[model samples]
Target: CLTGAPGDAARNAAFLVDHSDCPAVSLAGDLSLAGLAWMFSRAAGVVSVNTGTMHLAALAGAPTVGLHGPTNPLRWGPWGRNVQSLLPHSGACAYLNLGFEYPDPPVTCLENLPVSDVLDALERMGLRERAFAGD
Candidate 1:
């Protein structure tokens, strides 16, 4: 399930939904922020880029995986017992004190972290089976 702010956010994620191999549903406009957090609280697990939702989900006490790139995990990673953070293997974008303070790099450093690594992290967290249940 892909839950986020509605309207333009949903429009922006059209390609993600289109390319999804597993069942993907958007509860974009259907829930308020608090409601969404509540939903996140009940999820089997959540995998989100380093963003507000990641923090929110972590605070809500959900099992969450935070994917990091330019952002420093030590400085900005979600804080929770069940939150596991994954940084790019390449240190090119690591430990950015203020991510936006620096000029943009030639390429997105997030691409340096492979999908297989994320799966491994999820597996370590015991989330892969539950999160992909029935997929």
Candidate 2:
């Protein structure tokens, strides 16, 4: 299932489904907050950027992976036992604080984060059946 808010969520779902091996469905912009929470409770795992969706997923007891780039994980990351937060390796982009103050210029966006890191995080979180196969 591909679920999130509109805009990037819809585009992301489309892009993923276009390249996916199996079937995929998107609930972006189609679900209420309660609906989202219920859906999250049933999901095997959820990977979300720093958004309310991430917090909701964690609150709903889903294994969640929160991706952080220009935001500090310490301040805005998902909270729970079944959660993991992914950040850039250089640690240069996490500057946002109090939703206003930023001490450094943005060095990169989430695009710079490696997919391998995400996969590894899922594996560590036991969300995936197994580690990603070597290519």
Candidates' lDDT values, in order? 0.81, 0.82
In model 2, the worst 10-residue window by lDDT is: 126-135
lDDT of 2 by residue, 1-135 (tens): 677677658696767767886456777788889999999998888898898989999999999999998788999999987999998776467777677655555356687789889888898887666433442
Which candidate number would show the highest TM-score if scored against the true structure?
1
Model 1 scores what on Cα lDDT?
0.81
Between which residue pairs do clashes occur in model 2? none
Kindly list the per-residue Cα lDDT of model 1 for residues 1-112, writing each as its tens digit: 7776767465636856678764667776788888988998888788899989999999998888999887888898989988888988884775567766554554478888
- For each candidate, give its TM-score against the true structure: 0.84, 0.81
